[model samples]
Target chain A: MHVGIVTQTYQAKIYVTLRPSVLDPAGTAVQTGFKQLGYDNVGPIRIGKYIELTVSADDEDAASQQVDRMCDQLLANPVIENYRFDLQLAPTAGAAK
Target chain B: MHVGIVTQTYQAKIYVTLRPSVLDPAGTAVQTGFKQLGYDNVGPIRIGKYIELTVSADDEDAASQQVDRMCDQLLANPVIENYRFDLQLAPTAGAAK
Candidate 1:
């Protein structure tokens, strides 16, 4: 039985931000709401969606190609939102690492 | 100059939920906070981290395997947090699909 794992990793340092000159009404609303709730330390809260996936495959290569295609096609909006992804493969049986 | 796009796709349905029997103080607090903010429709807001990545790979296979290893090794917490990832590959040169 072959197993494969798909994982997406985002450190706290990663942030989703709007273009400098662009206006962000949603972000502004969240910021105001946070202040009203007594969260003084909350700075400009730039919110972005984070998504990770796990997939099983016969060959890791084929699986990877399919995944990349999904992104450019429908997942991330290249015009307003930019995203990055990482893939993790299960170890082979006979190979000793 | 081959480009491999690492993409993580998540639908709104994906949620991070605590075990039914387990105690979740964080969830409780958030729920209370939402109610106070006039979001009466907000149910239990389960918060989880979403991460996506983009890497340039020489070959799709090698890239896929390497990414899988990173996930089980570090990214997703197998114990409490579970994650799923989707990969999308860029089109190959001189190959019409």
Candidate 2:
């Protein structure tokens, strides 16, 4: 009899942001809009991308490594952006099915 | 003698995500792209907005309130998106000057 390997589903929250040295035109534009809306005190706003995804892996370590590889390979533009992620065990794996 | 109130600067990290009932076309497109890149194990991807901004306020409570108002008014679309934020005291207030 062969036993099936159980895989756990993990939820990852990834944040991709422009490097400080890189210019953020979109952020500047939004700040200007805020000022025009009478939020004169708001300034230096920066915008970034937030992604949530589910991955199935054998363990937490495997899940984290997978997320890291995904970010480095396709989620972030290395030259001008910085990426970080947090991984946690999903409350339930049923949704991932 | 008149004393000046020293306002502390707080940094807010805001996340805006689509509601569960809403469809995420961009996320689906990205998931397809990931599969094309050979990340077959990744699925159910959702994309959203992340924002960082500094607000000067008398205290943490005031800063939190300000961030909440900003999210409700400008950072997120209530019709389909939900917003949450984390506020912390900035390491230095000089940047906001």
Candidate 3:
């Protein structure tokens, strides 16, 4: 069986945020905490998404397209949060090539 | 055109680790950091994956199956690290139903 695992590799991303309009106490707390820690140079505490995922396709083009669709159809709530990410490809290990 | 972001929202998981045998300086640093924070009740700080995603499909079953395949073919590295996640579905906004 071709057992495998999916992570922040391949064709995806992980998004996090403060549920819409909900007070971001964590973000505010962190900002205050940072100030106390002597890092007063930070900008407005815009706490938002943390995205991670991996993609698999016959090639990169199709993977990108499908992943884009997946994102639109599901992953992110376009109204509230913003996201960023990194991509990586993991080569198969100990497998007959 | 429909545009979206595929985060750790649906049909996915994010697998993270210290890059296979690479010393986890951050994890070690965090463990120590936590101890200094007076949280001596913490464990070995086995830090790993953080996943968030959203899935949309005709329904749930097909999405789950396809996501499983996507993961096996790409998202994760079976050789190292560990994975976990959460799934949610976002309804269309400001659209005629």
TM-score of each: 0.37, 0.92, 0.35
TM-score of the first chain alone, every candidate:
0.57, 0.91, 0.53
Q: Candidate 3 regions off by >4 Å?
A: A1-25, A84-86, A93-97, B1-97
* Least well predicted 10-residue stretch by lDDT in candidate 2 chain A: A88-97
* lDDT by residue (tens digit), candidate 2, B2-94: 847767788899999999999999999889988998887786899999999988887889889878887888889999999999988788873
Task: Write one digit per residue (lDDT tens) for candidate 1, span B20-58.
Answer: 455556656655754575434323333344433333344
B1-97: candidate 3 lDDT, tens digit per residue: 8757332223333344434464555556655754575434323333344433334444446446644543344444656644444433434422211
Q: In model 2, how large is the Cα lDDT of residue B50? A: 92
State the lDDT of candidate 3 residue by residue for A53-89, as single tens digits: 3444444555466545544444446565443444445
Q: Residue A93 lDDT in model 3? A: 19
Q: List the residue pairs that clash in candidate 2.
A: none
For model 2, residues A21-56, the per-residue Cα lDDT tens digits are 999999998888788777766758889999999998
Leading candidate by DockQ: 2
The better candidate by lDDT, 1 or 2, is 2
